[model samples]
Target: CAISQEELSHARDSLTSAQSALNNIQQQLSTSVALVDDTVVSSHPDVKAAAAQLRQAFLANARSTLVAPVTGYVAKRSVQLGQRIQPGTATMAVIPLDQLWIDANFKETQLGKMRIGQPVEISSDLYGSDVKYSGTIDSLGAGTGSAFALLPAQNATGNWIKIVQRVP
Candidate 1:
């Protein structure tokens, strides 16, 4: 059927508007897909945060089920089920006896004469006189034990006292 020129123009205008709407919807869909891909592959802050959370969840799941890293006998088990183990917390120590050292707390006055690489004669009460480990001074303290105390001395008032400082 032959249509009027005015009706044909209206039909063409309607088709053009519908095409514009379809193009807009397609653009939005493309943008949504790109965002989803970025969330999975891109290393943005939000993506990294989500990945870190997923990794932590995986670690927590693994911790819920314990798996030993080394094949060794349980020298002494301290952790029980449902017990919490925080970061840097020592549940137990594996003493292979392959390495050992003696911690000696010499007086501040005695350390005055001590120097790096100086020979040291260590005598333990447990071993008595039978065993003596001859070693050298590895390192010295920066300050006295009292300096790093929990409750450090405070001299807020004008009252002061002269203390002998040692240097090594």
Candidate 2:
């Protein structure tokens, strides 16, 4: 079926109106982007913070290039003279041999007799038989290990059976 000239004219007018609306929207978006860019240039806290961060970064960069934070014998030197090192990039650890804590994972049952002020004995498997370090129990965990587990038990179901739970 052939369209009348009048219908074709109306269709053209509709298309032109839609195009005009699109153009207006585009102009508004462009203006908004420009405004945001200008704001970033003028009064951005992040930009100001970036300047300070760059100083710290440069200090880190300079340390990586010329000097090091903690100079030792350089036991394990991973990087050569001119290598791009990133932040938190463990070039070498400064093992001061100052102090360290032994992470002892006591069972949930044993924790019942333990208290914050209660004295306790700690033995290391690496040391063997001999008691290495002794310390008081700092605190009990607020929740059990299963609390932070990936798939926590869902007790929301009506068909769920009752079970006694233990917490450290």
Per residue, candidate 2 scores C-alpha lDDT tens digits across 1-168 of 999999999999999999999999999999989878656463678788888898999997776554645434444667766678787776754443334434455567677677877876777788886756766766677776577678978777669675545664
lDDT of 1: 0.75
lDDT of 1 by residue, 35-88 (tens): 876564556788789989999999988867745565444556778777888776
lDDT of 1 at 122: 78
Q: Relative to the unseen true structure, what is the C-alpha lDDT of residue 161 in candidate 2, on a scale of 0 to 100?
A: 73
Instruction: Assess candidate 1 and give its TM-score to the true structure.
Output: 0.39
Error of 2 at 134 (Å): 1.6
RMSD of each: 16.2, 22.4
Candidate lDDT (C-alpha), each: 0.75, 0.71
What TM-score goes with each of the models? Answer: 0.39, 0.38
Window of ten residues with lowest summed lDDT in model 2: 93-102
